[model samples]
Target: MKLQTLRLSLALGLASALLAFPTAAHAQPAEDHAPTLAALKALQANAGPGAGVHAGDGSTSWTLSTGTGTVNQNRPIQPDERFRAGSQTKTFVAVAVLKLVEQGAFSLDEPIGGLLPGVVTGNGYDDTAITVRHLLQHTSGIPTNGLPLPQAGPDGTYTLAALVKDGLRFAPAAAPGAAFHYSNTNYEILGLLIEKVTGLPVYEAVTTGVIGPLGLTRTSFPAAGDRAVPEPAVHGYRGARIGGFYFWLDGTVYEPSNFYASGAVISTLKDLTAFYRALIGGEVLTPASLAELERTVQPGAPGVEYGLGITAYALSCGGKAWGHNGAVPGYFTQTLVTKDGRHASVVTNAHLVTNVPSAQMMKVLDTALCESRG
Candidate 1:
């Protein structure tokens, strides 16, 4: 990262830390919030505590948190406690790239191989055949690269370039633009591509471009060697080997640097809701850019499709909630918003083990957006 860019990022994050969101200003008239609260508590019960949430419609917003902060279970999980957003970082990367696109820094249809040169090659991967859109939509055909098990390498395997190179051990999943294969290699490549185009670290680009502009005071990317979660965090957990047996280990101490642009973002429930609301509401993106981000491709799931780093979850009540879900060892989280502005963000304290069931989580979000409709 450039010294100038680092200074700008720190300045923006510090200055915005004191800004407040207009949570209750938009009034949608009173509605029963009991169901929302109930849904969150149910998530806590199954997800191993820290079921923190921030949800709202166009005119109303609210937050709720259940259970205690960590293993000792001494204090309640605060609604604003920061947690890893895992793969959701892709959404931020997509936004940054799109902003650059608006400024003529990128062309979605253009080959990113030309931008990053030899960064993505071998293992049947050819950067020349992959376009920016292919990367964003997970159609680059890069095999799904797995992260080191938290027990093996808590902080993650390595950096974006390292991960891209590591991904070549397996052959390509398919031909570029062949299908939506859901590869982190796609976004890892995006991080490198962004750096090449802007001459700034991907984190710096996202901070100045998205976090700062959105006034997401509580949202940030973890810096290198910053293994400790910032204070007042809802600690995450996963299984770890101990005495020849497995036990719950606090996963919060791992390095976020290894996640790079793929899943290093740390944010609170309120920030999660706010960021997605702003992005989906057209406050952070130009109309054409937003449209490009929302263009969907089937990812082999029922009632679900992916756009540029965004996922559309089918609602039980008839509309789709768009956003992303992230799982980074100890933390499993999701943030979604409808086109009409109804939205929810939830984070469970554990993942990989004693974690929230994917279906249960989907229902938790779906109910948050659907119950009122019924």
Candidate 2:
């Protein structure tokens, strides 16, 4: 069977199994169940237009759109809207590296220096000591370039090497397996290493090896200054409070090159779901590599857990899921899938904020996805 057909068959089989066995009679109250499509739509409406939800089990899916505005002040968000997957792009990079490992091109424990000479950050720590495993697990002790949000300008055209060098300025905070300090620099370095080893640009390597195999035509690593927003993309926003006054700011179109492999891919809900289904279904990496990818290295804070390049969580409703969440300057997004890849993909676009609402919305969406397994 073709790969896509095989994946759908596996998903259907799993869904059939899950449906065949009903949950315990007294597990939880029906009133406290996950949100329905209507409920999710109402919640997004409350949050504001441009806010939306996409949920689907292997058998069926739904996209709930609410709010209004051109995704780029020019186009409307529709059923097929695409958006930057943001840090969720890390999962793609991680899978790519793992595939290379499976092919005998590299090893997880191999030092990164040999792969990309003159690219490893040179500081007190031995550059040769950091392994590909450390990069995937976010335990390399690499500090980010301190520039959390990139300002658009000529300066925005900085290269991946510049970003890695900026991160190297700071000494490693802890020993290689110590703890997790999320840093874009890790994946940026990984991207460079992929390019060095494959003799292809990061984008080309990922597209040929992963995206094409998964049939995800809607996803791509766009170039810098590409203002052509994907069709039906949602507009992202930012909110803040200053001197007791609350305000919302419009987010600019994300420059994919600015983030590179760390967080730059643009994809729609359908394509994103397709990619994860293929990944967890064992189409991208070897069985051993997939096991490594799903192994948790460090515990993410409340409501999340960190694996090699993914996040796992036990929903409040019940059951476990794997996937990642992402945020850029003007947008925030969450993607989740069941351990068996049978659950839905939950994505929401919100005005960025450091507040409780975003967190609450995530919880709602997660619970909804988990409980909707039936």
Candidate 3:
């Protein structure tokens, strides 16, 4: 039940990326994506056998992919292809909750005990002390047991309640709002809160609150009990070299309930880029709510700040991009958009575990954003 998403090595694999850059950041025109594509291609050794990039703004956009979508065949991963977006779903879920806040469904400072009642008991936790803001900001003092304990029901689907219960089994990581502790339990609780208020499933509530409003055409959630990836997907793979032979495990059909509200979003590069752009551009939330989301704090990560569900990454090239990185089992996705409207989303059909050069992925994002003129 362990996922290889953000539990990644930040070790920079900069040699290949530094040598591969073909253009200065100032030379890239608004419409040119070739440079970004080149950076993505250079990461094939780590991100293969499937990788894609979808970037640009509302005026112009570009899509490119290298490597095969299948294990044996040479079917290339293409643009607008669907893949699991992992924890990127958190930003969407956070927006959904904030939209509910705008609608006065509940306040961000409301205690969980008041909102859901009786759900936040025991485990040395105080529901009243844990606010919605704490959960969103990962300061809820919840342990990180949510991912390790994936207790699915008989149908292989995980209930948000079950996920939260497993998370509560462990004692508080710290006193409420004491430290930045990224845990799936906080989001699972938010998912439950979303359900309680809207009387709709998490997926339905998010669609009505965020996706539909944003016109994310190809983004969707897999229906309950369904494990099939939608058509034209970048099939995720996990590979290992044993002795002299190499093997790959296709995780494209990974269970939708595996991460529930904490992850488990099926999306495309185009859809994700557009969503992040809108989010960073202030189209998704009210000015007040968006301000609340951007009230960030250092999460003990270098050049990165944790906000509500999104993160702000300080680019080495200067400036910051707001978005989230996502990974399930085999799929990994990174999306970042500047406040100035430039955005980039890079997705690969492989977990960033093992010796995979995750820093190359970061380089792709930096190069894409830095190279953009708009």
Best by lDDT: 3
* Local distance difference test scores for all models: 0.75, 0.66, 0.78
Question: lDDT per residue, candidate 1, 273-363, as tens digits?
Answer: 8888888889888899999999999999899999999999888889788999998777889989988888888787777543347776777
Candidate 3 lands at a TM-score of 0.88
- The residue-by-residue lDDT of candidate 3 on 248-310, one tens digit each, is 556677777768888878888889888988887887788999999999988997999999999
* Model 3 weakest lDDT span, ten residues long: 18-27
> How many angstroms is residue 220 displaced in model 2 relative to the true structure, after the best TM-score fit?
1.1
What clash pairs does model 3 have? none
Count: clashes, candidate 2: 3
Q: Per-prediction TM-score, please?
A: 0.85, 0.80, 0.88
Lowest lDDT 10-mer window, candidate 2? 18-27
Which pairs clash in model 1?
26-59, 155-255
Cα deviation of 25, candidate 3, in Å: 21
